[model samples]
Target: MFQRALICTDFTDSMYRLAQFVPSLAGGGFKSLVFFHNVSVESGREIPREDPELLEKPRQRLQALLREVPSNIDVTIDVQMGRASESILRLAKQHQSDVIFLGTPTRTMLEEKLFGSTTARLAEKTGTPLMILRPQLVSTYTTAELELRCNHLFRYLLVPYDGSDGGKTLIKKIHHQVKTNPNSVLERVRLLWVIDENVRRELLGDNPMEQAQQELDKLQSELAALNLVVNTTIVEGSPIEEILKTAEMHDVGAIAACSRSIGGILKWSAPSLTREILRGSWHPVLFFPN
Candidate 1:
C-alpha cells in the first residue's frame, strides 16, 4: 500500500539492515526510499550543544551498506541529533512518505507506559502508515532470509475485519490506496472476523455467524473489484489469537490494522484487540494511523 517510504532505524533495533536491501524493497513496490536515523543529544552538561560529528558515523554506516542503487529507485540517507519522534515526523513529511518503518520489541503494557514506545507514539501522531518489525526477529534473520522478506513485505496482508466503522474505514483506505496506485504491490488480502463467543454473542444476536459471513462477502467484493485476490474468514473464538493463528497459517507478510483515529485510539482502555496485536505479534504489522 506504500510507494515512497521513510525507513527509520536505531542501530540497536537492526532496522538499518534494510539499507543493504534497496533492490529487495523496490521489488516490494517502494520507488522512493529515505533511510533516517536520529542521534539523541547528550545531556548533563551545563550548556548543552548539538554536535555535527555525532551524525556523521551513522550517515557513513548507512551509506556503506548500499552496494548499488537501482536506476528506477531514489534513495537517500538522513542522520541528525534530535528527538527521534520529532525528527521522524519531520523527515516523513519532507520525503512525502506513505509509510515509515520501525522496529519495536514486544513489551508489557506496564513496560510500554514506563519506558515509552516511539512506534506507539508515532501511531498517535502521524497519518503516514508504519511497518513495525520485531527487533528479536530482525536481529536473527540471515541476510538471504531478510532479502526474501523485503521482496514480499506487502504482497499479502492479513487484515482483521470486525465490520465496525473503523474496520470499514480501514477497508476504504486500502481500496483508496490500491485504486490510486494501480500497480500497488499489494496483490492479495485475507480478511478475518473472529466472533467473541463470550462478549459479542449478545450483540450479534442469534445468527452472528451468518451475519459475519454476509459482511465479509461484501468486503471481499469491494477489494476484489480492484482485481485483488481477496479471501475472507469467520470463526468463533478469541479475536487476537484467531487472527494471529490465521496469519501464520497463511504465511502473511504483515497484519494490517488501523485505529478510528489517533484520538479515538488514545481513549481505548486496556485489552483492546488492536493494542494486543500491536504488542504481541511477532509478524510485521502495517498500521494505518489517522
Candidate 2:
C-alpha cells in the first residue's frame, strides 16, 4: 500500500539488488523509487572530503540498474557522504516517501549491544513506516520468487493484537492509511491474540477466552467498515511462538506490529516481543515506531 519508497542499502547488504527488479516492484503499486546509499565520512579527517570519483562509481552503478525499470515509473539514485541514519531520514522527507526499505542481517546479541543497529536508530528518529527484509532470505530469491515477493508485499497483513495501547495505535494507523490511500494493496487483515499460558492462573469467574473473542469481534467490525476483510483468532500459548506460527499459517504478506515504547538505545538492547518478531520472522515486517 505504498506509492513512493526510499530504499537504503550498504553495498554489502544485498538489498541494493532490488534496483535490478524495479519493474517488479512497480507491480506492487510503487510509482516512485529512490535507491539510496550513504558513504560514511573517513576517519582522521577534521572535515569530510567528497571524492567525485568514489561517488561516481555507485551513482553509475545505480543508473545502470535503473535502466531495467519500466520507463513509465519514476526512479533515481542517491549517493551521499554523511551519517547513514541522518541522511536516510533527510532523503525520506525530501522524497515524501511512504515507506523506507531496509535490509537487516541476523546479529548476535553481543553484536547488537556493541555495534548498535542502524535500523533501530532510524526507527527512533523517523515517522515513516519501515519494511524490514532479512538479507539472507532476500539475496537468495530467484526471479520468479522476487516477482511474487513484490506483488504481494502489502496485499494482506497479519496483526498481533492484545487490546493494549500499542494494539490500538497499530489499528488506528492502518485505518488512517486505508482511508487516505485509495490504491492501497491492503485488502485483508488477520488479527491474532495469543494468551500467555505462563502467567499465574486466576480463579476469577470471568472467562478470559470468551472476553478475548468479544474484543476481537468488536475490532473486526470496526476494521471491516473500511472495506477490508478481517479475520481473527484467539489462542493460548507463548506469544512469540504463536504469533510467528499464525503468520505462516495465514496468507499474509507481512506481520504488522509496533514497539511497546520509545526507549532509544535501551529499547533496542532490551528483550521485546516486537523486536523478537522483527528479527525472527521470515516474512517481511511492517514496523511502526512508538
Candidate 3:
C-alpha cells in the first residue's frame, strides 16, 4: 500500500536489518526507501559543532547492510545530527514518506511516563502512518525469515473494532487505502470485537454480542466490496488481552488501529484502547494518527 517509507534505526533496535532487505521490500510494492539515523547531540555540549567525521561511522555502519538493491526501488541512507523526533519528521517530509517504520520494544507505562516515548511524540505530530515492530522480535529473526517478512508487512491485518468513532475512523482509513491504491497488499482482514466485562451491564444493553455481530456484518460487507477477504469475531474478556490473543491465533502481518485521544490534550488522561494496543502488541502495529 505504501510507496515511500522512512525507516528509522537506532543502533540497538535492529531496524538496520531492513537495509539488507531492499529487494525483498520491493516485493511488497515500495517505490522509494529512506533509512535514517540521527546522531544525538551530546547532552551538555554548550557549544554545538558539526563534526562530519563523527557521523561517518554510523553512516558506514548502516551502509554495510545494503547489497544489490532493485533498480526500481530508490534507496537513500540519511545520517543527520539532531534529536530523533525532529530529525525523523524532517526527513519524512523531505522524502514524502507515506509509512514510517520504527523499532519499539515494549515498555511499562510508568517507564514511558518517566523517560518519554519518541514514538508517542511522533504520533502526535505526524499524520503519516507509523508501523512499529518490536526490537525483541526483530533481533531474533533469521535473515531468511526477515526477508520473507519484508514482502508481507502490510498483507493481512487483525483489526480490533468495537463500534467506537475511533474504530470507525480506522476502518475508513483502511477503506481509503484499498480504494486509492490498486496495488495495496492488504488482502485479508479479521475484524475482532471484544466485550469488556468491566463495563456496566446497563450500558451494554441486553444483546451485546448479537449487536456486535450485526455491526461487524455491515463492516464486512463494506470492505468486501473492495475485494478484500473479510472475517469477524466476537468474544468476552479484557479488550487488550483478547485482541492480542486473537492476533496470535491467526496469520497476520500487523494489528491495524487508530486513536484520536492517544496523543494530544487528552493523552495523559485518556484510557485509550489504541494506546494500550500499541504498548502491548508484539505483532507489528500499523497506527494511523488522529
Tens digits of per-residue lDDT for model 1, 3-99: 8999889899999999999999988888999999988754443324656677788999999999678999999999877778888999998889998
Which clashing pairs does model 2 show? none
The list of candidate 3 runs beyond 4 A from truth reads 43-47, 262-269
lDDT of each: 0.87, 0.84, 0.89
The superposed Cα distance between candidate 2 and the true structure at residue 116, in angstroms, equals 0.6
Per-model TM-score, in order, reads: 0.95, 0.93, 0.96
Winner on TM-score between 2 and 3 is 3
Q: Rank the candidates by lDDT, best first.
A: 3, 1, 2
Candidate 2, which segments miss by more than 4 Å at Cα?
42-47, 203-205
Name the 10 consecutive residues with the lowest summed lDDT in model 3: 260-269
Residue lDDT tens for model 3, 1-290: 78899999988999999999999899898999999988887655643575898788888998899989888889999988878898999989989999999999887677788878889889888899999999999999999999999998888999899999989999998999889887788889999999998999999989999999999999999999999999999999999999889988997899998975545622644677887888879999999987
Q: Which pairs clash inside model 3?
A: none
